[model samples]
Target chain A: MSRFARPHWVEKMSSGMAKPLIGEISAALDTLAATGVAGAIDLSGLPLTATDRAELEVALGSGEVEAKVTAAGTSEIRETGFAGVWWVRHFDAGGRVLAEILEIAFVPQLLGAQGDDIDAAARRLRTELARTPERETGRETVHAD
Target chain B: MQIDETTPNAARSAASGDDRTLGALLAARGVSRRAFLKYSSYLASLLALPASMAPAMAASLAKAQRQSVIWLSFQECTGCTESLTRSLSPTLDDLIFDFISLDYHHTLQAASGHAAEEARMQAMEAHKGKYIVAVDGSVPVKDGGIYSTIAGMSNLDILEETTKDAFAVVAIGSCAAFGGLPLADPNPTGAVPVTELVTDKPVINIPGCPPIPEAMAAVLAHVLTFGILPELDSLGRPKSFYGESVHDRCYRRPFYDRGEFAESFDDEGAKKGWCLYKLGCKGPATSNACATVKWNGGTSFPIEAGHPCLGCSEPGFWDMGGFYRALSVPTGDVARIAAVAAGAGVVAGAAAGALHRATKSAARGKHHTVTVEELEEK
Candidate 1:
């Protein structure tokens, strides 16, 4: 018996007819100019084809900053060639793309969560300390150098 | 920031007629230049100015001299004053209030009787063609403005006499902007907004049941910084604050776009955090910064607290139809309107379903198959 499995549905690389990306970029720029605040375009929520993604990449190109942040999974942040604009992607632990976003701001809001993460770590540490055998005495007898 | 132990020397400044700049007063208050600049940046953002304008705003505001303001009260509930007083704790708004030379305020000033009247006269004379006149309530034109008065003077007489030499006037609340509750149906006292009376001087209307405190503070900042009133819309409101409707900036707009609406107060849709458009939210038509700037120091606003907007900032909102009635559904001939609305909704639904199906089929046709080898190559 043949063991070859049939290939299922796969997304195609579209013909480069994706011009709506230009409007999205323009709107983001307009918003930033009018309001001192920032806005985001969630590509994951849109029906963007592979060709559309490639076209957007060609238009914006790449920029300097590249950072990998960890939450439930890895979130990649890359600055676009356009000043004050960024390309961000979130991927699950299985390496499946979850979200793709184009952010326009003085600074991306994704980086502002370090303080909250620190607070979470503090709570976790306190919980772990409470379960220790020496915690009942409420005093530190052994010290680790 | 530290208190300089010297109470504001408004009396002395007025007596000597010395043009002391705001920088000098902030210096006296021990407010550092950096802190002042930070406050300026905050004000710039609050006023919706570009971030690059912060330094210029700071420089201009710093050099600007104290503005003599005369506050008149009439046919009002004192709620505007109460709202202005509820700024953030140790608020910058209070500091800005302190920076101004408030010459006469019936509710706030310690002086009563002839003393208050004398203060007003002196300040008006000293700062002729320079002072700002801020009125908080409606002026009753009917019956010779006899329904309200100050020191035996009718509200109308006092308003005309006081603003004769004033550079500009700021109508502070809905009462002063559009004749609030006092001018409701069967208005016997014949209360009218200040804009109706003060035609000579420029009037800026900060219309709200009780206008936002920051809004009032920002307007004062604009006057103190630029030496002019901020840009006004057709209704004489500051365009920066009333530029967009509450619905345009609402957080639940995505739900609206998805056509998920809450039909009632405690429905499953409401609990699911759906749009409140069907539940009488006037946000779509109401223009105000309550959805953005919020109240009580950037805290939750009415809509955020699950209450429909009452369109308080717009003129004549009080005379608008029932508060609980949706903007789409009018009060007159409800049965007819409902039937028409239902018909329109059905047609729209069928059109939307067809469009959605077309989009799905197009995506399917565009789809291509990839082998394991192709995935490995990528």
Candidate 2:
């Protein structure tokens, strides 16, 4: 019975269906270009096999922009070879991928600094400056303009 | 694994008469805008919403006030509460605590007895029609609900009163969602799910023996961020999590398609990691996120660990045949046979037979044999 058993299931990871996914991404990119509307495809929600993912990665290649955002976890956003396409992966503290997305946009939304944060930064800076001796002594206002 | 024990600065300020938005609270804790953006994007993906909605979700969450939550336990094992506290995702646990003011929970609260009760009443009165009511156990309505009571108040009465002005009623576990184990066959106490009693409010069912922690957090986050309930399925479960059957997402799906099955626990096929359908896996009939979101921080689900799905998320699962019996096999008086079979299976067959009869009688529907091609279409 042992001899008659088939190969291990791990060997069947490749579904050989990456071409259609690439086509779908191309179509999304086209839509973004035409309508100026960014779109995203949730890779985690798809049924892509390991080989399919590998094929997609190779097809997309890599672009110049790459940044990491740390919040609830660490998110890595990198531009694909295509100018308007980006690959985003959000990982938990334990380094587990929580979500994988392919975004079609000029820049991923997570890269931009929000208005609330900028306001908070300004207040925080003012508080720090108030605690400085130079500011208290009236030496910081040297620019008369 | 590092739990931040210090109370967030925003929470402290809120206590000191500073009414601040969640954005101010987060910023006080030195959480940057990028973090919010990342979390919002992650939430959007998790909720199956379009990626374009991430910015809006973030904006809404930032401007929103902290939500008041009241947790009421009935005839339960406290496993649901345990599951929630042990949420594997690091940030989600913090985010949930930061987003809500848990005014009442018997197990976790410092104040007990009268004080705890008063806190719940106060929160209800203050928040009124805005607070969320999360219930975790089946309500024993038999004997005038004398089977279970807190402070001499019956579970039924408490549920009705608490949910009267609630924004939404969240059924936290299988017991609260589908009348879990307590409602099985010879249900002596006449237990029923939360939906039966709370008819006015939107009841979101997150059913499992002890539901996946992330699913619970995600539902709460969706509600808190959007100021409304997430889209629910026919059974009142969030479609984002319960949209697909376990088998549809299982890695062993290829084996099932090839007709390769594990015959027994220690068989060659089992060792070779074949499909467990023959050994009574309930994956096909079960709709849950266990296959994808998994448990224990994306490590592995029951199927990955070589156990067949118990179909814990579905209604009347406790009565649905035996765990080791195939779904294709029709059951007859399973409750009685389960007794003779003893420990081999729980309340076997009869419940499944009853369900089939119920479905047929209600819909006058025919049970058609599905072909491989038809299954592929789905």
Candidate 3:
């Protein structure tokens, strides 16, 4: 009875949230496969116990692709063990999580560079290329025009 | 008088006659799509909307016009305004300013005297039924509202006139939502909440001593994205934020369930962060986002700091009972005598026991069932 007491503590800590959330993720995965429409679940909005969160993390192991986006603040987008499932977390300046979500998509939208940014990058590259000296040293300089 | 505009982006756009959609405005300002995505996700989470709604919300917000807002302050302290300004950081929350054209505000606006009043009137005339009127204080109606007046116009008169053509009304604090402290005991001013006067428009109440800044921001964002108010509870509060009681989300809930309560402020249980329920915590009865969204940027709430919740968001919180009196204990002579005896250190245990027995006996006798209709009538 004394040895079983330890396991009871673990059970007491559990909010019984991880199992249902995993089921939701599976359903979302099925939806994504069938209709090519991505789904997302806001983790921050739910009242997840610490033990439940740990269990969720253990279930959704890390995958290959991992990307960090820096805009107003930093954001981490990582693929989970499931192919179409990704874990996205946005952090404030103080590194506190502002929002977290489980995204079911081929690729999370934040990872892609926007068209406006691409256009701005092109103009910036052109300006930098034009500013380069024609014959400063041994390397040949290419004109932007 | 000078008119200070705090929201430079919206003001600048309005000044330049740039009638482009919000998406175009963000692009013009070099705001990246990633930032918009992040903000949309945050807003969606705050509003308790499904995560899939982030993209739709972002798209809707981008195409939406800046919402016109007219802020009116009446019989209350400036704590609500102070809380909003101080708690909203320059991160995603500040984007609320860019989404709304705050045509008139007493505290945040630079205009004073006739200039401020004229601006409010002009905004009302220009936007008509398209503008939102946000009020932060209770309206005193005693003696024709002579207690509080602005520009020789009583609060009741102003609230009635401003809300006549408004799209919606937002009661920003407990004062404006539930008549708050001013309508507590004795009721000298005959104060009443915004819902009492404005029956025509949708009145959304964000009832807190000072509501969570994020909640306020999220409500505005919801309006901007959906062109309508969020789902409201019976008390006219946003169900997303006020759906759960503070005790339900409190960190010390386990201690409460385990029957490990701190009997005193400096006890061993107190040091170990046990429950404060015995110390008159109103968390069990109070519904607000304080325990979750928190104050000072998710830092801590009153219960987290070892203080009992005052149930500030509820109607008539001030007159409910003594702040240090437990909810189970009935208010009036017995509790008052117990408190006085305890203070005097004169047989405190006996007084407490008597009080407990009195409460038990009272409970046994009073089997009156209160119906929803009866509660509503009260």
Candidate 4:
């Protein structure tokens, strides 16, 4: 493997320097793992075929966890015990790659000065989630965490 | 004390001829009155003043040829001068002929050699204590000011002599205002800001590579009309213009609040036009009214052009890291730290800001409610 391909070495690289491909990918891990807000990152290594890249985008962007139906037939969102998992990927300046996918679970917080509006809260969260740039930028059903 | 109405004096006539009106001045001479008024108001408003203040802004402008302004040029590309002259809306020509008296600008005026020196001395004598002194570029203080000189006089001596009895001093461009480009990294000339040299009078600093032309105009107007100087900021800049940062008024601020960022330069986020905060925008640290005041008569600003703000208006901006990297704040917790930037220095409790962005969004959702108990079962 080239000096740029090792994950451990990449992680150790200086944050300001021109990052090796793997090092660039590792930076995404740092940006995402620390923040719940998912970001698209780029990795120079592991050039996924166009078909594979599309499939991954669909899988990640698909809000399958949010779409899960509770055991009682209610929405997973209404279920207090529910949590959602998502992967944050890195992208280049032009949306190409250089990093590992950092997966984290999002525990939605109760909204408002008085948590009085549940449905309103749900719709609000839905919009925020919509604006979230998914790998593929679309919706699909998936499993909840 | 009654405000004395004697500023322009002989300085105005000498620098720009005895034409009070811009239309007549431009007509008989060259720059128009309407264009002059337009230029006057355009720059005044950039300071966040009312549009109606333009006429009053103009009347107070000292225009006597007696008002000698010795523009000291130093280690600079003269981009500020070029930028000043290229102002097309009202045009820089109006400023030169109609604004405060321009006595001896090396860039303009056909006088050369001993004649130029004589012209400068003549204007200084004619205006005396009433003239305005403006300095461009940085003054090198090292090696007894040996790095730069004019007529064998060091930039330091020239500055000291001229600023001794000036009505008010204006430090135009970043060079004079702050150390500017010359002060950037390993400065050899021992370049120092104007603040270091002048101790007797209040110095107005108009910082930027060349500074906004309107900023230069408004300062002249403020001094001419008010004569007591406009309100200054911590950096000694006028508060009217440097009061707010571009980030506070950016149109893409909402996107940042929502945590939506442009993924790349040409991706869907870029196509949709998302926030450039993630892309090394120095807007947050910068303090300038560029977003609200805009440029070229409300034409467009840096952010409006679909680029991240380089924060050129802020001091030592060039030394900052790359313009495409996001500033890293302490990630106390994803939710909590996000609130810090969101609350943005508000002490109403960190979570309050998060709650506000949440409540506001929740109120907009408008959906049917479901109980936690029901969700637990069906």
- Give the best candidate by DockQ: 2
Stretches of candidate 3 exceeding 4 Å from the true structure? A1-12, A114-145, B1-16, B329-378
Q: What are the candidates' C-alpha RMSDs?
A: 17.7, 7.9, 8.7, 26.1
Please list the residue runs of candidate 1 whose C-alpha ends up more than 4 Å from where it truly belongs after superposition: A1-145, B1-11, B89-91, B328-378
lDDT at position B10, candidate 1:
44
TM-scores for all candidates? Answer: 0.64, 0.85, 0.82, 0.57
- Please provide, for model 4 over A35-84, each residue's C-alpha lDDT reduced to its tens digit, 9 standing for 90 to 100: 75433222212323333444444443455333222111111122111124
Among incorrect, acceptable, medium and high, the docking class of model 1 is incorrect
Which model, 1 or 4, shows the larger DockQ? Answer: 1
How does residue B208 of candidate 4 score in lDDT? 76
| Top lDDT hit | 3
Fraction of true inter-chain Cα contacts (below 8 Å) kept per model?
Answer: 0.00, 0.58, 0.49, 0.00
Clashing pairs in 2: B321-B349, B334-B350
User: Which lDDT tens digits does candidate 4 get at residues B1-378?
Assistant: 111222223443544445454333333443333333334444444455544354455444423222345666766778777666665333332354344556677777666667666666766776677777788888999999989888888989988887777777888888888888788777889998888898897889988765776677667756655657888987888988777666666656555555566756787776666767656665665667666545554455777777888767666655544466553222223334444434442221223222322332232233222221222232
Clashes of each: 0, 2, 1, 40
DockQ of each: 0.02, 0.39, 0.33, 0.01
Better of 2 and 4 by lDDT: 2
Better of 2 and 3 by TM-score: 2
Error of 2 at B281 (Å): 0.9
Query: Lowest summed-lDDT stretch of 10 residues in model 4 chain B?
Result: B367-376
**Lowest summed lDDT window (length 10), candidate 1 chain B:** B367-376
Relative to the unseen true structure, what is the C-alpha lDDT of residue B283 in candidate 3, on a scale of 0 to 100? 77
